[model samples]
Each structure stands twice: as structure tokens, then as C-alpha cells.
Target: MSVVVKTSAIKTVRAVTFACLAFAVAFAAAPASAQDMELKIIAPAAPGGGWDQTARSIQQVLIAEKLARNAQVINIPGAGGTVGLAQFVTGAKGDGHQLMVNGFVMMGAILRNKSPVSLSQITPIARITEETQIMVVPANSPIKNAKDLAEAVKKDVAKVTFAGGSAGGVDHIMAALFVGAVGADASKVNYVAFSGGGESLAAILGGKVTAGISGVSEYEGQIKAGKLRAIGVTSPKRLPGVDVPTFKEQGIDLVLTNWRSVFAPPGLNDAQKKALGDVVAKMVKTNGWKEVLKAKGWDDAYLAGDDFAKFLTAEQARVTAVMKTVGLVK
Candidate 1:
């Protein structure tokens, strides 16, 4: 009787173990669970801009991952993203449903343009990705590489104009920094501001500007089509599959990288912040999201919660110092 009982006990244990394995297998194969909550992602620029693209990507991933039922993107364009920033700080207090897409460009615009609603007034949710700005010239241009561009800029900074996004934006800042790094006066850089890359592309193609500065992705299509020549990228290393070398590699010591990220409105409790951060954190880990990053030509620079807030502080100081050096701020 004792032998029979011991054998029965072993059999029972094996049965339970098998059941657990089956359950695990079923869970792994199940579809992503649907979330009931919907959220609003604000793109504080016109449609077809960087912020709008980021916001739309977030919406796509959030819904496809079933992290949110829907993520609606709203565009509020003006004042280099400050116009919408003011509304977020004042109206979205304690509302975790609202998120804004901004980047390194905002820091310059806020300082140089003297925006009333600074990033400090909002909640820093996450740093999503970083992109390298590119120095591009039209296919017909004489400037062939970063060295050639440097010579042109140093010859007469004002005569060698850079066409890019709005004033005080990352494109503008990159052009200024490149000029300053090459012994040219940063403040003297002839930066022609436009609302979007479309406008800048047209100007560059039409020979209205000496060169163009924008995200490498912004010029990828034209570069591939032989419409534009990418001289150098602001990245520290050459990007894979892209022929352009780094600004450092081209004998220019300047390295300029712009970040794209999300922020929430102030007045949220810790739980609310956690919820938003968790959603983004999960979104980043998904295979779909990883593919999105690859397709969009953005590098993974994900940081969230307390660490992100600290990053905001450091970035504010760093950008402020650069602004002073470039004479964008007094």
C-alpha cells in the first residue's frame, strides 16, 4: 500500500507540471490584450513635420500593440512649438491622457525665442529617439564634402546660407554650430527658416540656398534619387548602408545630435506618471515598435520617469550654454 501511494503522488506532481507548461504555451500564443483607455498625443507643429511624425508613430504603435484603444494625434503649429506648449501647461494639468511630442529643437526655440511656457513647467515623460542632422547640397552644387562646405562657410558665413526648419530649431542650431566650429561666426550664419522640410527641399533644389541642414531621414529619399548630395552626418559614426561619413570623420570636430521625445502636462501623481511611462516602456520593447524605429531611421534613445526628468535638467543646462555660445541667447 505504501509503494502504491508514493507512485500516485509522483503521478500527481507530473500532471500539475504538465498543466502549467500547457498554460504557459497558451499564454505565449495569445494575441495582445486590448486596452480600454484612449489617449491624445499632441504634435506641436504643422502636419508633415518631425513632431507630427513622432506623434503619429506613437499613435500607430500604441494602437497596434493594443496598449491604448486609440491614440489621436493633434497638430498645433506656431512659434516653433511654443504656442501649443502654452496650452498644455495651462489646460492639461493632472491629465495623463495628454502627451506632447517635442525634441532638441524646442530647447533652442524656447531660449532663443523667449517662450513663456518653458519645458520646466511640464512633466518629462520619456526621451524616445535621437536623429543626426545632415549637411546636404543639391546634386548640381559644387560643394562635394564636409571639407568643401567648411571652406564655403568660412569664406563668408552670411553668403553661405543654410535652409532648414523654423528659426531657433535644431536645423538652424546645427548650421550655426557647424559654422562656429569651423572658425566662422555662428551668429552670422545665414539661416533661412521654413515651416517644413518640403519648403527647404524646394529651396535647395532651386539653388535658393547654399546648402541645407535637416534630419538625415528628411533627405534620404532625395539623396537616394540623386536629387541631393549628403555631405556629412552629425553622428559620431557613419550610418550603416548610408554613404555619408560623420562630421568628425570629414575633419570637422563638430558633432550635433538632436533628440525626439514626449512630455506630459504637470500636476500628475506618481501613479499617473507610472502608467504613461509603462505604456511607452512596453511600446519600446515590442518587435513592432523596433521595426518602426528601423523604418523611420531613428535610433533608440528610450528613457523615462525620474531618469528622464533628470535628463531634462541636464539638457536644459547644456542647451542653454550652447545657446549663449551661439549668441541665440544673451
Candidate 2:
């Protein structure tokens, strides 16, 4: 009877061990289910801006494709995204479900504001879209074209007030570059920064500012409505379906495009980073994401993995050099 009891105990132990190993193997083999993914995308700017628009587009596509169980966007607007960056770094550390929308604007903002939190703290996922910047004035303004605007800036750089999003953003950078390209003093550019696109649009429409610069899509509706007159677009050549002449065509040697990208929070391990990146990579390839790009007039600038990382590094160096040359930084 004692021997029988001992044999039964050994059989039970072996069976339990084998069952546990099988469960482990199955769990390891299965992919993460959609129900397990809850995404929170940070816009890092108020609504109606490029960052907000990008974040929402991502959210919409992710949900429509069932890539995520749920997704939401949180706006924290200030200091050209530094305010939001600080919050993201602290609040979302080690979280793979959290992503922040950022790009050239934040790059310049970090340098200009000397923000405590920088992009280095985040894991880059991908660069999604690129859009041209449109220079516009109120329809009733005297500046009829890019040339007229150039003359105005040359006449008085300090008096030609330009309204755009954030102090060190792409809009501000374009304004300064435009001034310099037109043989005016870039440092004296009267750039008035606004926290949101709506505020700057109001300022432009009310004629409070001399002109405005923003992404083409942001001002496209107003331009088409005859509320605003597009003077020049920062593209090497005229964009398809966009009637505005290129800055180069207007005899201004300037070309720039604002790119938007997504980043994961810090502290993600290799597997975590790869998992998040795979989701984004999948999203970008979907028809839903492509439709969003087409509707928004955004170019398919999708880049990912080590390629995107290398591009980001190069962009930082390029932006820093340009900012220094324009006197935006010493």
C-alpha cells in the first residue's frame, strides 16, 4: 500500500509539470490579441493643429482596422510641445501602449525653449506623413503673391508680423527662412506665435497679423473659400491640385516640408519596441491609413525601423544647422 501511494504521487507530479510546459509554449506561440491592446496617443498640441490632426487620424485608422481595442488622444498644448513632452516622459514611462505625435516642430521647440524633456527619451516608431507649408494673407490684403510678400518683408521685417503655430515651430522657421531668402533680416521677423491653429487663423482673418504660415491642409479650406489668399507654398515645385505657386517659382530660394511622426514612451525593451513598431507598420500598410493620407493631402512619407531612426538623427543635425544660420539659435 505504501508503494502504491508513492507511485501515484510521482505520476501526479509529472502530469502537472507537462501541463505547465504545454501552457507556456502555447502562450509564447500566440500573438497578442486585439482585445489586449489599448492605445493612448498624445497630440502634444491643442486641437486643430497638425499634431492633433495626425493623432486623431492615427486613432481613427487604428480603430477602424481593429488593430487596437480602443484608442484615444490627449491634448496638452504649450511651449511648442515641450509641455506635453514632459508629461509623456514621466506619465507614460515603460508603457508600450502610449505614443506621442511629434516632428520638426518639437525638434525646434526643444532647442528654442531648452525644454527639460527631449526626444531622446522616447522610442521612435515611424515617420508617417509630410506636408508643404502654405504662406497666406487675408484675401483683402495688399500682398497679392509671394513676390509682394517678399517686398513687404524687405521693406520692414520688424513690421511684417507673421502669425503661426508656436515660436520655434515649422511655421516660425518658415517665416524666418522666407525673410532671409527675400534679403531681409530674419532675426527681425515679427513672428507672433499661437498655441493653436484656430487662434492664428482668427488673427489672420481679423487682419491682426500681417500674414500667416501653416500646413497647406490647415489653411486649404479657408483659401478655397476666398477668406484667405495663398501667397506661396514651401515646395520645390507646384504641388498637384494645389494652385499656389512654389516659393521657388516666386523667385524665393526656399523649400521646406513639415513631417509628422509617432514615438513610443521610454523604457520599452527590445520586444516591446518591436511589438509597438509592428502595430504601426501594419497600420501604415492598411487601406484605411492610405485613405486618410489621401484625404488629408499628405504625402506618403512612411519610414520605419532603423531607417527611420537614422533619418531622425540626420534631421536633428540639419534643423540645428538651419536654426543657427537663421539666428534662431546661437
Candidate 3:
């Protein structure tokens, strides 16, 4: 009877071991480790804006893929994302699980806002997506294409009041670049700044500005409704679904791809940066991430880890030069 009881106990232990092995195999094949805990993603802008969308996307994917048990987006919009940058630089030190969504706009924002804490203080995780900038005019206006706008801008740089967001944001930079490309003084190009896309849209629709510069995605609704006519897209080639020609195709030697990126707080060691970057790189390769990019009309421009850090340094210098030349930064 003792031998039989011992044999029964061994059989039960073997059975439990087999079950545990099977579960481990299944979990490994799953999206991500189901053991990860909560994560925090900060969107340094108002809700429903581009930064908000990116943070929320990170939140959604992390939770849905079981990469994290929970994730949240904290909005702190002001001063064109510099307000949040300042706080993050001082507060998020040594935080391994925190991230902030920032990009080309922030490059300009930092210079314009004159933030005490610059982007150089943070750690770059990855560059996720990029979009072509587009120039548009009110539907009722006479400017039809890139050539027309170029001629007008060349004739009187200050006469064509280009409207965009923030004094040094991508919109402002693109307008200045366009004017410079057309043989005009970029410093003399008149650019009026709005606090948000909604305000810029209102001004454009109300004919309060001569032309508008922004991402193609932001103006899709108005462009579809026949309220704004796209003059040119600042891409080497025309983007899919956008009927406008590229600035290059219009005989304008200009191309600019505004990219968005993810950055972590300072004080992370090399290992921590690699771990954080690896997760985001893996996330971008997922099907759910591809679907998110498709829905947002953003092109995948993924560059992770060291490569992204190098890119950030180069971009900072390039934009600084351009901004100085355009007189947006002294």
C-alpha cells in the first residue's frame, strides 16, 4: 500500500509539470510577456492632437498585446510641447518605464519656447513615423498649384501671409523652406502662427490667411469637403491617395519629411535604453501597429536605439541652421 501511494504521488507531480510546460510554450508564442506591469506614456500636448494620438496608440497596443498590464496617457499641453518637456527633464530622471512622444515640431518648439531643458537632456528610444508636409490655400483663392504659389511668394514674400501652428513649428518651418526654395528671402516670408490645428483651419476657411502649411493628414477632411485646395506636397514623390503633385515634380527642388519619435526620461543606462528601444522596435513590427499607421496616414519610419540617437543629433543641428537662416531663431 505504501509503494502504491508513492507511485500515485509521482504521477500527479509529472502531470502538473507537463501542464506548466505547455503553458510556458503558449505564452512565449503570444504577443508579449503577460507578466509585464503598468507603463506610463506622457503626451505633451492637448487631447486629440498628434502627440495625444501617439501616446494613446502606445497605450492601446501595450495593453492589447499584453506587453503591459496597463498604460495611461497624461496630457500637459502648452508652449508647443515645451511645457511638458521642462517637467519631464527635471522629474523623469532614472525612470525606466516612462516615455514621451515628441518629434519634428518639438525640435522647433524647443528653440522657440527657449525651454531651459532641451531635448538633448532626454534619451531617444525610436523614430516611429513620418509624413509629408502639404501646402494648401482656400478653395476660393486663385492659387492653384506649386508654381502659382511660388510666383506669388517670389513676387512679394511678405504679401503672401502663410498660416501655420506655433512660430517655429513644422508648419512655420515648411513655409519658410518653401519660400526659400522659390528664390525668395526666407527671412522675409510672412508666417502667422496659431495655437492649434483647429484655429489654423478656421483661419484658412475664413480666408484670414493667404496659404496654409501642415501635414497632409490634418487637412484631409477639409480637402475632401472642397474647402481647401492643396498646392504642393513636400515629398519627393506624391503620397498615396493625395491628388497633389510633389514639390519636386512641380519644378520646386524641395523635399522635407517630418518625422515623429519616442523619447524616454534621462538617467537610463545603456542597457535600459536598449531594453526600452527593443520593445518599441518590436511593437512597430506588429500587425496592430501597422494598422494604426494605416489608419493615421503615417508612413512607417522606424529607427531604433543608437541609430535614432544619431539621427536626433543630426536633426537638431540641421533644424538649428535652417531656423537661424530663416530668422526664426537668433
Among the numbered candidates, top lDDT falls to 2
Local distance difference test scores for all models:
0.85, 0.88, 0.85
Q: Tell me which residue pairs clash in candidate 2.
A: none
Per-model TM against the reference: 0.84, 0.82, 0.86
Tens-digit lDDT track for model 1 on 1-74?
35345888999999999999999966543323339657889999889877898999999999998899978999
- Give the 10-residue window scoring lowest on summed lDDT in candidate 2: 26-35
- What is the model-wide C-alpha lDDT for candidate 1? 0.85
**Which is the better candidate, 1 or 3, if ranked by TM-score?**
3
Question: 1-330, model 3: which lDDT tens digit per residue?
Answer: 353458889999999999999999655433333337456798999999888998998888877776678787899899879999989989888777778999998988888767788888998888999888888999999998989999988888888999887788788788878888889998887999887788989999999999988888999999999999998998888787778999999899888878988998998776566657777877888888888999998899999867878888898997887799778789
Candidates arranged by TM-score, highest first: 3, 1, 2
Record all residue pairs in model 3 with backbone atoms less than 3 Å apart, i.e. clashing: none
Give the runs in model 1 whose Cα sits over 4 Å from its true position. 1-34, 325-327
lDDT of 2 at 143: 87
Worst 10 residues of 1 by lDDT: 25-34
